[model samples]
Target: MKRSELLTRIVITIFSLGVVALPLALWAQTPLIHARIAEGGGWNPDVIQAKVGEPLYLKFTSDDVMHGFAVGQMDMQPVDIEPGKVSETTLTFNKPGIYTFFCTRWCGLNHWRMRGTLEVTGSETNPPEPASPPLYVTLDLNLDAPHLAEVVPTEKASARRGAELLRQLNNLPTYQSPDYYRLRSSVQVFQDLSGSGLTDSQRWDVVAGIWQSNTTPEGFAEGKELYAQNCAACHGEFGGGDGVFADDLAAAGTASMQTMNGDMAMSMQTPANFSDPQRMLGASPALLQGKILRGGMGTGMPMWGSIFTHEQIWNLIAYMYSFQFDYPR
Candidate 1:
């Protein structure tokens, strides 16, 4: 090699070494976070600080059972940490905000308690505009209030059975409107169809059809997946409020309530049974949306507004109502 060429090659080698060393240096600075069952200590040093528009490196180790880590609302793959093993990942935040990091696995009954926050501060790349209020908020719904349906279908309602009736009805556009469909409960929609001369069952079928129209097969599938991953732990595979964690959740709640008041001590209420027609039929989709986004206050439900996208929330709503209406899988 020529003298000059040899010097150039040496310089290039040194530059590559620096590039590799920079990331290693950053990775070394990150402390190893530990994960364990909720009872043991869900996530140690759960709070983390990072700068916006900068890449972050993290290290994690499982002290007990297998655990997976993923940030809420992020599009990154989850990192699985085996017992006594270290898992490392990198992330970059573009905006300044608080982000949630949670365990993706069901380690135990209190698995939902495995959560942490990432506080990203620095210059905002693009300042986000305020979003409009959710429908439940604008409607001023009392989510905790008892909402019971006066009438329920004698048999399970079917969207396929009501499709033709939905198409033939006058003022159908009014009923098909998104605002109308989301704000009105199944029972309310059935009452609206009263003067149309359809039998009670058919009216409910029409309501089912109306709901089916608002969501697509793709939405339902996505919702089903999301529910399985996030909600099934608490609500159950069939929306029966009998998930593996249900009993434990009730006990945890009851324990907390006992501290609130001695005279009114009572066991915590069980998770809502979506299959209960009387309650599900009376509750509007908007109301369910509110309860989901805001969470069940003091009810052990975690707020998901920071985790799921708006479209995802709507998809969950559609999938949940499937417990009431027979929409084919």
Candidate 2:
């Protein structure tokens, strides 16, 4: 070979080696979401947002029937795994947008229900932090959403069924208050959240916030003021259950806390005296708050939920606990 050609070939080889090494070096440093696939219908990661050009190493398996995984834009073919076998595939996404994957197998009746989404984000040196997941109050009954919701065979039916189930479970018909109505209507739809979308514990906290709320006054003085504004009207300015509204309220069944308790005593209701530490001793702050919010559903006791803020409610509860001791009579 000529001297000039030989030198040129050597340089080109060296440069090509560096180019190949560069991408692999970057891949070595890149982080991956590791997960195991089992008898589930969908991908272990149903929803994930990743940077473009990043590799997704899916350690997937299927112990039931044959399963397939495919991404349309990536020109990727479905990787199939038979029953009792492990399967894997490395997909390096080059596009910057949302991509979806689904099981192309008619494994079962819920085969269409098995799908997930992936969001390939644009190239940026420092990506912004992901937003916090919705509170349980925000979780839709439709486990598959926006994109995932489309692929379902009976989308409308699934949504309708899910909505009905939620209403029945939460006792929506008997549940009053505009707040609850709004909440019920908001969660009628569904979304898929099989991936690391939101941890179970976080979802539970959101549920807790929706179903219950409790807060204690910072200290005694604040508690006293809160009591005066909310409770004094019925319980008396001194927490003696002798305010001006007390008599009228008693006639309505709500003002008479003791009587209401007795009428519902056979049931689960336990109306305790705010001033009687013995009666109120075991009552939890949360339980007390719920009791006060709901009132007697079918009875004369109207729900006072609209009248008090969350903070005020807690403070009032604290003040009720304090009623055990007379305020200088």
| Candidate with best lDDT | 1
lDDT per residue as tens, model 1, 49-127? 9998788889999999999999988888999989988998889998788999999998987677798999999998677
- Cα error, candidate 1, residue 81 (Å): 1.9
- Distance (Å) between predicted and true CA of 160, model 1? 0.6
- Tens digits of per-residue lDDT, candidate 2, 61-113, equal 66556777666334456787666665667778655666666665545433434
Candidate 1 residue 230 Cα shift, in angstroms, is: 1.5
Instruction: Evaluate residue 64 in candidate 1 and report its C-alpha lDDT on the 0 to 100 scale.
Output: 96
What is the Cα root-mean-square deviation between model 1 and the actual structure?
2.3
lDDT of 2: 0.47
Report the number of the highest-TM-score candidate.
Answer: 1
Report every candidate's CA lDDT: 0.88, 0.47
The TM-score values for the models, in the order shown, are 0.92, 0.28
Candidate 1 Cα misplacement greater than 4 A, ranges: 1-10, 253-267
Instruction: Enumerate clash totals for all models, in the order shown.
Output: 0, 8
